[model samples]
Target: MKPVSELLKKRAAAVRSVAPESTVFDALHLLAEYDVGALVVMQDGKLQGIFSERDYTRKIALQGRDSRHTTVREVMTPSVLVVRPDSDVRECMSLMSQRKIRHLPVVDGDRVTGMISIRDLMDDIIADDEMTIAQLQSYIYG
Candidate 1:
């Protein structure tokens, strides 16, 4: 697997983020618009936290809080686990698996660079596996 930076490079879209002060409704809107499960919470261009569908489900919907009146900072996962640009795909997988999280923010210091999801890792892994299989088949057949 390649470094996180490489994956970031291959990603065609910019990192989707929302402000911590934004309403949960606003965050949810962005999530839906982008078709992503999670978003990096940025405050003044710095990584502040992360808001995910799980956060909305667990903190807002379960608690009966109205998203329009609730702020993302109030319910976001503030003590965020992040990966560096140089981090290995396996390292990210380990952290995500152990934490039972689907998303991880890629940061350089406090600056949010990108976000990675479980689907991204799975796609990369599957591509790598397919390439390896193709190589083995060519070697055997030739």
Candidate 2:
């Protein structure tokens, strides 16, 4: 089975992120621009928090807070669950499943390495299974 590092290596080299001081509104804009569900919050090249659509909905919208006035530090998940670049894909999947989170920030120490979504995992798993089935069929038929 391929590792999470392999998936990250196969995809783009880095994660999408914003500064912790950035407003929730700005973070929302960045998420829309990147077409992603979450953005890793970084400050001084160190991971700070993670902001997601759920945060905006649950924290800002539910509280009737002004997104433009609130910073990511105010609305983001401060205790973010992060995965290492060397972690296995199964480990990542388990984390996401157990936490009920769709997005996970991949970190290499203090640096943001990449971001992953549940969709990415499902796609990779499906592709791998298909490849395995095809290989088995070819061997049996040949």
TM-scores of all predicted structures: 0.95, 0.93
Angstrom error at residue 22, model 2: 1.0
Show the lowest summed lDDT stretch of 10 residues, model 1: 4-13
In candidate 2, which residue pairs get closer than 3 Å at backbone N, Cα or C atoms, i.e. clash? none
Pick by TM-score: which candidate is best?
1
Candidate 1 C-alpha error for residue 126, in Å? 0.6
Please report how far candidate 1 places residue 98 from its true position, in Å.
Answer: 1.1
List all candidate RMSDs to the true structure.
1.1, 1.3
Candidate 1 per-residue C-alpha lDDT over 1-142 given as tens digits, one digit per residue, 9 for 90 to 100: 5888888889865889999999999999999999999999888788888999999999999999999999999999999889998999978888889999999999887677889998898888888899999999999998
**Tens digit per residue, CA lDDT, model 2, 24-88:** 99999999999999998888888888899999999999999999999999889999898887877
lDDT of each: 0.91, 0.88
